[model samples]
Target: MSADPAAPRLSASGAHFSVWAPEASHVWLCLFDADDRETRMPMTRGEGGVWHSEATGVGAGARYGYRADGPYDPAAGLWFDPDKLLLDPYATAIDRAFIYDSALAAPRGEGGDTAPMIPKGVVEAPLAPLSGALPCFRPGGLIYELHVRGFTMLHPDVPEAQRGTIAALAHPAVIAHLQRLHVSAIELMPINAWIDERHLGPLGLTNYWGYNPVNWFALDPRLAPGGIAELRETVAALHAAGIGVMLDMVYNHDGESDAEGPTLSLRGLNARDYFRHAANGQLINDTGTGNAIACNQPMVRRLILDSLRYFVTQARVDGFRFDLAPALGRMADGFDRRSPLLEEMRADPILADRVMIAEPWDIGPGGYQLGHFGDNWLEWNDRYRDDMRRFWRGDSGMLGAMATRLAGSSDIFSGAMTRTVNFLAAHDGFTLADVTSYEQRHNHANGEENRDGHGENLSWNNGVEGPSDDPAVQAARRRDHIALLATLFCSRGTIMLTAGDEFGRTQQGNNNAYAQDNAIGWVDWAGRDTALEAEAFALAALRAGNADLRGAAILRDADVAWLDESGAPLSVAQWEDPQRRRFALHYRGSGLAICVNGDGEACKFLLEGQAVNVAARSVRVIPPAR
Candidate 1:
């Protein structure tokens, strides 16, 4: 291997390279220059299947991969083929796209089989000589959830090659759109190295949503134009725009499924230790996938912590949203409050400053622990989503629940836990457009006979299911969308808006389009009606501009005043009555009074003391009369 003299070695400056390769009898370091020529070097095997090489010349900007010699036993999850060229789990950069070749799948040393199936590794590229330092945006920031590919895939202004890559997102036009949206941060869906599910491949579909993570350190080559350097440039561009990037990480499980699944990377190396198993050695299914990561174990926790540190310090990632976060806390009895993984993450100086949002549930028993997370961690408020949906859909006995959600759900997030990441919709569920367009999930296109995805959508089709040409139905859907947006913005917590939700993007009722890479899942930027889209965009901008709406406070001066129908402070009867759905919430912050009319028909309700700006068939925020 050819090593760059200027590149920093893993052992230099307290850095260490590690890979789990239990089956490998011997492994070699193979470095390459920009010309793709090999620079061969030997690596020493350490305890517990770790291989290390110390050299001063090998630093960032060096191109390298690994070669292993091990048994190829697919049945036992050992797919080790050193001749196929494997990637380093600690690799910071990838050189090229993974060109699928059937020949690579064949058995080694055959007439047609060139080599064994080996994972490719990439070396870090040299830093730009004139690249300026980028600022790291901190936590307590508003994160705009978006798909890198979907965000600009259909935008009229974006170039074709740059459509789904980081370069496209950093394009001036795309950045302008984000700047106009006024989001403080962007929480990107899983961008780590991933593989399309086997089922998706069989159906000619792709895992466009990228939730299946294969390598925690390497960025997915599909999302980068010129490999790792390109990603760095993209991060630099986003940082220059003052927008931080938070990755939605899937650490609770690996891309490898259960015992029947393919032997990809980690599982193939060490399944018995990496994966959580029952006493009988059966894989745990807490992640709803085939297996759950053993986070309670020391080595597994170390791997997770190492991955996080690499992203934050090396990749310059600002924060992370842990997928199936409760899995990270599971132990022998159940979910442990004092899990060492959680403690280390909280106490770590590098991670402590970053935003740690959790999808605080798994598929395991007693997994839906929404508000039970410890201090300094924010949770995805599923309760808020359900309550908000019910109240807007005109469900009975929902008014009280709505109040608690609107005020940041003090009942759930009691004590030191304060912040809640509230959202009406996310990537896994129906889009805002689908919410009002379909009562039943239409996932038949997913090639799973419409049985996939959640059945309990809590959606209302507004008198007719699916798409309708009726202007009245369309108008009502629009009104409901606006109402939900208003409620989301007015609620007392950090709000997260799925990209394109502001413009009413739809997935044709496919709530779980994780496998669909077509136009159905891609954001239809060109189809947006400028007039309507502009109005919605303005509403989002307005929400972001209003400082009082960003997060919760102590309500120092009783900023919120609840009023009954007759212009009086809410009485005991009015507050207790389950039938009462219409009420006014006057907010003193920013000198605004928001009147919510939840009833089906518009009622002429009196204002408490002052004349307020009221609009028919709408949730109106009346600013103080100046």
Candidate 2:
């Protein structure tokens, strides 16, 4: 390989390109100019199977792809086709939308020519560098998990073209709405370039949530108005509004699922090296999606780290919420607290100041390592969600667990590590509205019977199931929603609210609506119940006004005070009582008091060391103290 300055640099060149096709004898870099001109550039095969090429004139707005000439074999997991135009794994921008031609689908039968359906490589055109963006939010920051499309697809104010893309999110009206909601950061569901799972695409549904990642470095062209550049603009806009952008990254697995899955990018290039294989040479199925990424390997670790660095340094993202993060921490032995990947990320110069959050578990052996992550990392507290749900739904023997969760689950995260990402619901499960309206899962709309989502939702239907026109049931549901929000806001950790939860968004009881990219998943901005929206807005305001409540200190007197049902100090007996369902938590420093009644009937809660002047059903946050 020549060290020419004009040659493409994978990390630096504006029109640089690289591919991993060790088995290929030769690879060609093809560029299609704006005037429909074709330029064929040969790639130099470097050490470690990486092919590279660069050109001076090839830059932003250029359309290009790659072609590899290699031996063809299906059983061995090498399906190389020189005729197909592959996308670059590192391409920062996509010049065109992915056209779903039948020829592009995975080839069937005895593998006559099975490469067109696979991921294509390309030489990316570079745009302006992303710098000057600061990390505006931290671990204790409030995060609102939202779908870029879903948040504004039905928004009356958003333009038609911008409705479901990054452009919509950057709209001033959208920014103002989020600002009014009072969250510090927006944890967007995955926006990485992904292909709809073949089955979902066949069913006329798309991968709406964007969890299946194909190219870690490229933004999904479908989500961006002008491709990747639009994504950068959206991030910049969010940062300008004092809101941090945290991407939900799926590094645990690639879009390529299993043996039957399509050979998108990484798998076709080097399946054996990229994916974990059993001793018998079969693909490991730890991700529950057919294959697991080889995170323990040094080169694989470097790839993952390099991808993260690219996003941080180039994309200027504020933080990353790692999806199925336990897979990253898995080692040859088992889940390790000091995993090389985790340690490297913690110490990395570019990643050190960013917020590092983890889903904290996978489906593999010892996969449920929730509280086992390192100190600098914030974990999704599933235990908090479960316990809080049980308490609110009138379950017994949950008082202790609820109390522990309210105190930031100190048992899971001890000392200074008590900061958790607490939430009643996220994108994966039923929305807060659905949780209170459906006792049983109604995922038939997902076309997978009712067996697609989690069986144990820990939800209550409030005396009726599904949607109910009964005003009483509706009022109860609203109250339950308010209670859950209050609990989340007053809890001793960072809080995350689903996008539509604030305005009562329902998936119509479809908990796992990953494939429903249309109306099912999109937030109905026009159909919002104004009263409920106001309540949500008020809850956010209350949370913001009481800074001590969301502060990092576990023993801090500024935010929290324990009180009995009568608003007096909690007694030892009351703390130990399994039947107790009501407590008063007062943020003395912030001068806000919240009374919670988890019991079926209302309970009179007293303010500790203060006279009880006001009361409401289930839960209520008192105004700031005079």
Candidate 3:
């Protein structure tokens, strides 16, 4: 644990407890007995607003929480209530997962004795730091984003006991699947402890996606029953097989939500200092989840850095993909590329070598900072996704856009080394199969009446709204999937494939399946399209075998020759022709040619006197001459 030495540490007699609550009038370390009885021990106020306490009898495995006594002004963002037990921000292990209760949201004095409902931080001894080789993943590698539970819940080989847990990932069947995909890293989506939204309990639904995080350091008990050790062991197992792991972390907001939300860890401890607030003293809603963490604040930055270091030192994971990353760089004025938190992360020795990717947008003002994260970060490129879909959907005037996206999206990323993580589909939207099979979102199961997901998905139904018995429709969808995957694999920079997207996973057109913890969200391993899976494997192999395709360098005019179907250099008129859809990009140095035909008719392209035929709505990668 690279966290501050003041963090809870076990000694010969018992344990030393410490907390940072500068504004609180007093703080108490509450330890829970076997029967859930609480004993509050007074903590002595220390320098710099931190409180310290020595528990002579308490040792490892002791369930404990903190109670801070201070102001209780909601409007002024000073939420403090001794009734609401708070989890330690430095807690590495939690006794149980968080479940939403209406009482958790009740006002300070009204929500009496939340200890019964709240999860306690289990006192733990820090694991020895891992020392090994650098991360196995690198730029321009395939990143597979998957929810831990959804990915393995249906796996027949994974044990029933181990299913849907971090330990399950170490199973040989799972590692074999990853190896088949040639995955450089598997990005686990938000394994941190989280609470369900208050509305979900009433709707008979719960948060399936773990995006609503409550504690940054503690692993979700449901995901890792063995706690941090399970993660460390799983990571070691994956690394031994040449696969890296990346956590999709959420630092934008806690599950504590708004004033009406639950008084979890940060909100109950020091809401005024931990969360960003407006001039009117209202919590800032930059994250769309209610309150955004004050990343610019020194304590918040330290916490975030400490969390990152703890994961690295303990688990030895490859890297991280920050969810809604703009929140990390947002200051009082606006989002700054050189914000203290962002700069510190980039400069941190432990984190500098690790792969860092950014979601790159939020709902806040100036939140869509795509290419502004400077040189150290790779960003998820929405433009690539949109343009690729539009082009394959047969939208007019998308030839240039499609070519740009396939060429590493130079227009968006204006650097020598493109920082784009191009993908045809992601977890939050329609799957690749759904993109070709559904024109509208069907999310009534989510209780949102199909109005929750993105309205204009730039998708096509291919003569059917969803699944169809028509072989022609099925063939068309398969062709489109190949085209989409080929475009992504043939692109210049890093690529990401959401779990099951490689094998035609569909949410029945439910784009926003965040609340679907049932069969709708789990990857149907048995029902997956084997042919599509084979195509994905072949495409991955193709990308890996070709140096030109996997390189991160932005293509220049000298490096690539843009040609029309006739093999002649593309003219101004041809580039401007909206109706034209066939083109070939021949990499001059590698002698490789990528021929794309977005038209509904198969087209043949002449490359250096050799004719290469490409199917309609498909892309063909032609190898160089012998």
Candidate achieving higher TM-score, 1 or 3: 3
Instruction: List where candidate 3 sits over 4 angstroms from the true fold.
Output: 1-6
Candidate 1 runs further than 4 Å off: 1-18, 22-43, 47-49, 53-86, 97-119, 125-141, 554-557, 588-591, 611-617
lDDT of 2: 0.75
Model 1 TM-score on a 0 to 1 scale? 0.87
Candidate 3 versus the native: TM-score? 0.98
Q: How well is each residue in 1-626 modelled by candidate 1, as lDDT tens digits?
A: 22211122354543234455666777667766665667656777776667666644665556666666677655544555555455565565555444334444445443242223334465454343332233354323356899888887788898887888877867888888878877677888988877665567667777788777767777787787466566567776888888877889998887676665555456645566677878766788898778888887776787788778766665476778999999888887888767999999999877887878899998897798887777777889989998999888878777778877776777777753257888999999999878988999999889999999999989999899888899999888888888887788777776788988877888999999887788888899877646556766766676666655555642222767777656667787777787777667766655566677787776665664554544444566665546
Better of 2 and 3 by lDDT: 3
After superposition, candidate 2 runs with Cα above 4 Å error: 1-16, 32-42, 54-59, 69-77, 81-85, 99-125, 556-561, 586-592, 608-617
lDDT of 2 by residue, 1-626 (tens): 53211113444445566666678788878777655455778988887777887666655456666667676665565666665556666565555444344444354333433233443333444555655555888655689899987888899888887788877888999899899888798988998787767677566677788878877777776787476567677878888898988889998888777777765566656677778887766788888888899886766787778778777766688889999998888887788978898889889888888888999888899999888887888899899888988898888777778877877787888785476889899999999998888888888878776889998899989888888999999998998887787788777778899998987989998899988877888898777777888887887787777665676556443446778766667788887888887777776665567677776665555564555533333667777766
**How would you encode candidate 3's per-residue C-alpha lDDT over 479-545 as one tens digit per residue?**
9999899989999999999999999998999999999998999999999999999999999998888
- Candidates sorted by TM-score, descending order? 3, 2, 1
Number of the top candidate by lDDT?
Answer: 3
TM-score of each: 0.87, 0.91, 0.98
